[model samples]
Target: MSTTTAVDPTKTSSLRSGRRFGDAIFSALSHSAGIVILLVLIGVTFFLFWGAKDALVADGSEVRGGAGLIAYIGPLIFGTLLSSIIALLIAVPLSIGIALFISHYAPRRLASGLGYVVDLLAAVPSIIFGLWGMQIAGSAVPSFEFLNEYLGFIPLFSGTVTTTGRTMLMIGIVLAIMILPIMTAVNREVFLQTPRLHEEASLALGATRWEMIRQTVIPFGKSGVVSGAMLGLGRALGETMAVAIILSASGGGYSWELLSANTPGTIAGDIALNFPESFGVERSTLFVSGLALFVVTFLVNMFARWIISRRSEFSGAN
Candidate 1:
């Protein structure tokens, strides 16, 4: 009976109050972080909008809408999309393959080393890639002229080659290299997250390694792969230095024909190249181009989020 006395109700109440207080503090911190993020987003939108106001207005130009803005934005948007699309095409498959190798096939030691190499690649700076593209890739273009020549018939690659290497193809290749790390890392993580139970069950069902991965691993990780690729696409769309150094015709519209050497100018590249020298209306035009980029990137990210959300809902329902 002496040992049966419960702990003091007052002490228990105090402990509960303390936990509640700690939880409130943590909740406040999380809310503050979210508020800060919202503020930053708003600030960027306001700054860019304010900066580009003049360009959004109709000038005396034939185009009724913001001609200057359109003119400035025309090439940049195409270039950004073009380069990103190219990078995605190359990076996504390779990343999936590498991810599969690491997750299902490779020994632990080998997988770790390969993963480390991929992580190291992600750490490599854009400037370094740009420099390498300029120095080495540029020089090697001639050796690979067959690719250019074969594809040159396409309006996009019609540009004549010079001693200096800057071509759409070259820029695309450079972008592919730049985005590889992002896609690979994402793929690896998503694949690695495949539950041991699911994998073992798949194998026990007489499934081949590839069959297990295709049915179980990929299904589980598809959304993550898409997320990763979207992130890489964002990076590619905004890439400046490497594109600036690698693209030959970073100022004009798309080459309608394939294999055109003319480098389509991306919005980010144009801003980087011309913003410093621009003034008055010209500067405002650059801002307008930036606004366009902001819109497109925003839309792309929103679309990706929507897709992911829908997929998540579907998965949850199942």
Candidate 2:
């Protein structure tokens, strides 16, 4: 024989109603947040375009550089890309290696300490980095006279060396150091998240530690490395203070000479230096430069997203 208990209709209805109420509230909150973010992005885009309208349509003579939009903004964009590229080239590989060591190879105690140190490094202010780059680090650039003298045959090293030691090369190095912590932190986290089973299985198949890392770990964390590198690149691109402080204006146009004081001007640096004194067309021109930066940044992010998406197409769903 089976016994059955009658359910209370009042309790059942109340429970369903409460759940529906909570879900509605949650949906409303999430939708509101997304709308707010979208609105802010739209606002920024509107500001950039509206502020730049005057300069975008202005005559070459009225513009700051007296050479028109492309001619003037070209050098700044080129410089920005060049310096950021230099920093990425130096930082990405080093960051990955350090992260791998911290996550996979180091003693737990030492790794814990190192992780804290990296986080602290990230928390340090950008302006402090600028001051340090300008004063302490820039001084070391002159010591690389051998690079200039011996490798002078290369156009990159062929330039009039300055006594102050402020050059594009130093800016790149400073940017590298500034962005290192960010990339390393992301990489370490990603590496740590690699499946224990996958790693162990590779090792159990007669693979050495390095071989397991090469096959299982690197493949799993490759996307993370790209994402982290993109983040570092973004920071490098928008770097205003460090580049402004270290950048000495000898020739504020595009240059292939990394060792020279005659380095190219970045858009952000140029705007910071000139915006206060600017007026009329010059002011609008600066806005146009800002718009250019926004465009470039957006394009870069899109390209990176495309790359990651393409890579994902070849990866297993799991």
Point to the candidate with the largest TM-score: 2
Task: Rate residue 126 of model 2 by lDDT.
Answer: 77
Q: What lDDT does each candidate get? A: 0.77, 0.86
lDDT of 1 by residue, 1-318 (tens): 889777776555544644477889999999999999999999999999888776666473622123455564676687788778877888889889988898778999999999999999998989889888888765765754665577666645555654455665567778888988878898999888888888899999999988999878998898899899888888988888987766666455655432345556777777787789877667877777788888999999999888888768544225
Q: What does the lDDT read for residue 40 in candidate 1?
A: 96
Q: Candidate 2's residue-wise lDDT over 203-317, tens digit each?
A: 9999998899988888888888889999999999999988888887554577888877687878888888889999988899999999898899889989988887887864434
Please tell me which predicted candidate would have the highest lDDT against the true structure.
2
Alpha carbon RMSD to native, model 2: 4.4
